[model samples]
Target: MLEHGAAPPSSEPPTAPDPVPSPGFVGRLARRKPVELLVAESGRGEGGAALRRTLTMWQLTTISIGATLGTGIFVVLGEATPLAGPAVAVSFVLAGLTALFSALSYAELAGSIPVSGSSYSYAYATMGELVAWICGWCLVLEYGISVAAVAVGWGEYLDELLHGTFGVTLPGAVSAPLGEGGYVNLPALAVIVLAMVFLMGGAKESARINTAMVAIKIMTLLLFCGIGFFGIQAGNYAPLAPLGAGGVSAAAATLFFSYIGFDAASTAGEEARNPQRDLPRAIMLSLLIVTVLYCVVALVAVGAMPWRDFAGTDAALARIMEDVTGLGLWSVVLAAGAVVAIASVVFAVLYGQTRILFAMSRDGLVPPVFAKVNERTGTPRANTVLVAAFCGLLAATVPLGELANATSIGTLFAFALVNVAVVLLRYTRPGMNRTFRVRFFPLTPLLGFGFCLWMMASLPAVTWAVFSAWMAAGLALYFLYGVRHSRLAVAVAVAGRD
Candidate 1:
């Protein structure tokens, strides 16, 4: 049998024009790019420029934390609290566990494959080109739309901060979209552009700034916990699961969005100083830190404020701070912190999106412009600028209510593919060296895939319909462009001629 990612051995005479039959259409679609080729091609860019590998494990961890820990904690509790009451804390744990299973699979693959494409590359090396393209398409939605979504959320916190600090706020015409009862959302566009500027400076610099912002947000949450702890009433815990197990499950799906950015580290595989070792450690460590912080903050927020009162709350954490302190001082502080927190999410997630496109472009699955690197900064400057423009425009003009759920479903789909790819790689390349392995092998990855499906099922049917339409569009694009331009297909064709 032919080895995965390798061409078939030839048996024809050397004089034959074609030594072997070229891979059939199905075979071309399923062709796995050799891992060695992928690694060898890593960091390569037009004009001999390459991505700089300056990120340490700590920076990688902070990147993931900065990406995953911000927007959800600052805003999602209000949405989930009414669903599960005080048991929202349990909902967070349940969501974290679901993320844990996928994180394990991600860690294993990131350690072994260690490419900038994240799950997309893992799928390419195990599943096939078609699956890889689908995974990559899903990532585009996950990171791109999520960045816009987070940017839109940033505008709300900015309004809160400005209103608290100064005597006034930006007019709704400037702060919100037309669909949301205003003109363009200038604040959202401004925040996306700000994050783009940081990313354009390069990954290491972006990571440094992101780490600082992450520290501030962490301290902010800790401060909230400390102040809010004093107001905890055991009475709030009376009707723990008021809405029952179904509510907990529903809330868990909502909370799952909080876990989305934990895989941001995996997207930095090409930039990591020691990808095989550091990537896995960063992924797992970041998940651990984010989960602990989430569970702790959820408990404190629920204990400090009754779940029934959480229904209409927007910034639940800041409101809780006000209730606990009997002063707007801490509330303003939390709002200010949320602004910084959401900005970090925009920065980190945008960085991941650009890198994913970089990988896809290198493989000829996307336009070459995305793979071009700036010689001075060692960054994909044009790519960053383009992605920023798109996301910023989306944030400025779109009413992203149901669209936000599309981001979650897209992420869940990509994560499920990652879990499946990890298992396939284990079977196809058992001898491949891995710095980290998913414990219990098949069981671990199987559970990861199952959990992804469960959370996806919990989403609204409208989200599924949206996902299906997006996928259909992707398939059409792949057939029209990606399949014809794919480097793997070209390589296979050339090998057959030899």
Candidate 2:
């Protein structure tokens, strides 16, 4: 509908990019994209490619659940249980509580903003362009690495399921990364490509597929509980607090990764049929469901055997199933469930990562080609392809151990910023139409920020170093390209002249 670079019908006309006339580098970088403009541009959809409204609260909730219930709960128990002993359930609760506070803040913002780009857009509106760029950059790392990591994990589980369920063998020397005893990890690449196919199919279709997969994952866990609960020895719980308060909190910090994906719900803000009401509900519903599932799994895993034996487990749930039921069949089922769950994670997170890039591209903060949506599919196929290809390459090359834990630190920083944006918006634009506001007003956001900071502090110094390097690289890129081409920056420059 646009001819010769005119703005979309409903949005403001972008300033013509003739030259970097008045405002030089520092002036341009200091410029802020007004909150009103962000709100106006968002309703026009990513830049101007209005996303199709397809997801209901149920579909949105499943995306969150499917993303959260991946390899974390399946494999992290071994690492966390040793630190918290039988009190690992308490650790799940603690992590869930921290994530819960952030989810509430996210609910408030998503309902109010109802836009894509997640916290990145929110920060741009409430904070400034620089902060937004950094936050978006952190998200890029968070999601890109996460998708690759999940794909790699999915490959391992797929190998297990194939060999166990059928009489097949995936030669690790051929199917895994060179550092991980394989040449290229074909299954990981395959899954990332399949995710691209699913995502390109459109949001509604992907949501339906994700819903079915999440159900399978949940049912598998339920089967584990139904069988494993019978083998519970209450005696194993007596010395539950053997690791003490410090240890339990430390374990809680580690367990925080398990609850990471509930925010993937917010990524669907623009796609939600009723963003104001549904976004908030989906966030709360998904968090509560995942929390309870995690706690129950922790309790069952600890109750079925000695907590000491949980350390160094490869696939915690599968091993627990075998050890508790003494049945190879149960173990195989759990392994298949893990494979399905991790695949869902890769799908949803990959979907989220692309949408984030699409949002950024619309603002001209990145290559504008990424913002182009496929008119036929009503999806951003180009962005999805770019993200999927890069993630696929990373998955095909990087070993799991080589993938840094910096993703979590990046996530925690973003959550903290989301909470800040919420507080600032509350004071700055108190009358904004927020269908779902956080309860307890300022208290909830403060707690959310505090919780995120505490967990971020718990990460290792090396993780912080890696995170800093990533942020620096992001700033460097922003200065080199983002500042000059940003639609908002051009608009601001024009406004100053006027």
Q: Which candidate comes out best when scored by lDDT?
A: 1
Expressed as tens digits, the lDDT of each residue in 1-498 for candidate 2 is 001121223232354223233456665554555555655665344445667889999999998998788898888889999999999999999988888889989888887777778999888777777889988998887888899988888888888888898979898776888866778988999999998999999888999999999999999888888878987999989798897998899899889889998988888877889877788888889999999998998899899878998888867777777777677887789888998999999998998898788789889999987888777667888889999999999889877552447888888999999999999988866655567777787888999999999888877888888888888889889988998788976666676688
Model 1, CA-based lDDT: 0.88
Best by TM-score: 1
Give residue 83's error in model 1 in angstroms.
Answer: 2.5
Per-model TM values vs. the true structure:
0.94, 0.92
Model 2 shows how many backbone clashes? 0
What lDDT does model 2 reach?
0.83
Candidate 1 local lDDT, residue 77: 89
- Pairs that collide, model 1: none
lDDT of 1 by residue, 1-498 (tens): 001122233243333122122357887788888787778888887567999999999999999998898878988988999999999989999999989999989988888888899999998887788999999999999999899999988998888888899968899888888778898999999999999999999889999999999999999999999999999999998789999999998898888888989999998998999998898889989998999999899999899988999997778998888888889898789888999999999999999999999999999999999999999999999999999999999999988887777988999999999999988888866767677777787988899899889878878899899899889999999999999999777776788667
Error of 2 at 13 (Å): 22
What does candidate 2 score in Cα RMSD to the true structure?
6.1
Cα shift from native, residue 428, model 2 (Å): 1.1
